[model samples]
Target: MRGYVAMTAQEVAEFMASGLFDVSDVYAPTSQFIVDHQDLDDEEIEYTLSMVAAEDALEMKTATSGAACVLAFEVPAESISESHDMSISLSSPLKWESLECLFEVSSDGEELTWYATQEIDANLASWLK
Candidate 1:
């Protein structure tokens, strides 16, 4: 995976939200996909549901091999003392040519770790020889 462009979770988030990342032909969901296959944790579900509610633009990362990118956001505090944050990680297989095959993971700020949630669209899956 060397020489593949790498970005931090914050960088990925900014790329998605700020439109710096090109999203042409990419799937930017207005809501989390309700698939029966994968089940997300509470924190992961919360992040996905938030995306459903917000209009922020989203983007996918490019991968060379086993590559991953992360998108993070700060959840509005329920109270002044509460600060909840979440991050979603997107992964792709070796030499992926497009956003297809991307999968998702979520992280709560407390542990700074990710939990698997969903598999992204595989529109380009057939493009492979």
Candidate 2:
């Protein structure tokens, strides 16, 4: 965690232009493990997932086949306040996972809040982990 080089968007954009943050690699879905970080408890994972990727500005993948996929987001806009919009998708090849989000991040980058129907598989138990 301490090794990551966090930079301002301007610096990041410059690096991106220079191929520092390879866009393809940055977003590539992988199981090719980096530092297999210690497992984070459900409560420790702070996230906002209320919208769909196809419809909402942001979307969260529902858990499937016991695996979950969600978007790692950044609030880059300035006009949004209180609440905004998003689109959540619950899709997976696993067939057992249903990804759900507790809420959404406001456009202005406030804390998390969400819509009502943002759960993947309600039947999935807490014992799976």
TM-score of each: 0.20, 0.23
Candidate 1 lDDT over 9-125, as tens digits, reads: 344434434544432122122123324214765455544543432222223322321223332322122211211122222232222222122222222212222322123223122
- lDDT for every model? 0.28, 0.24
Winner by TM-score = 2
What's the CA RMSD of model 2 in angstroms? Answer: 18.2
Residue 47 Cα positional deviation in candidate 1, in Å, after optimal superposition: 6.4
The local distance difference test score of model 1 is: 0.28
Worst lDDT window (10 residues) for model 1? 75-84
lDDT of 2 at 23: 20
Alpha-carbon runs more than 4 Å astray in model 2: 1-35, 46-102, 118-129
lDDT tens digits by residue: candidate 2, 1-129: 000111222322243245323221111111222223236332332221212221232222223222122223232223112221221111211111111222333433344343232242241232122
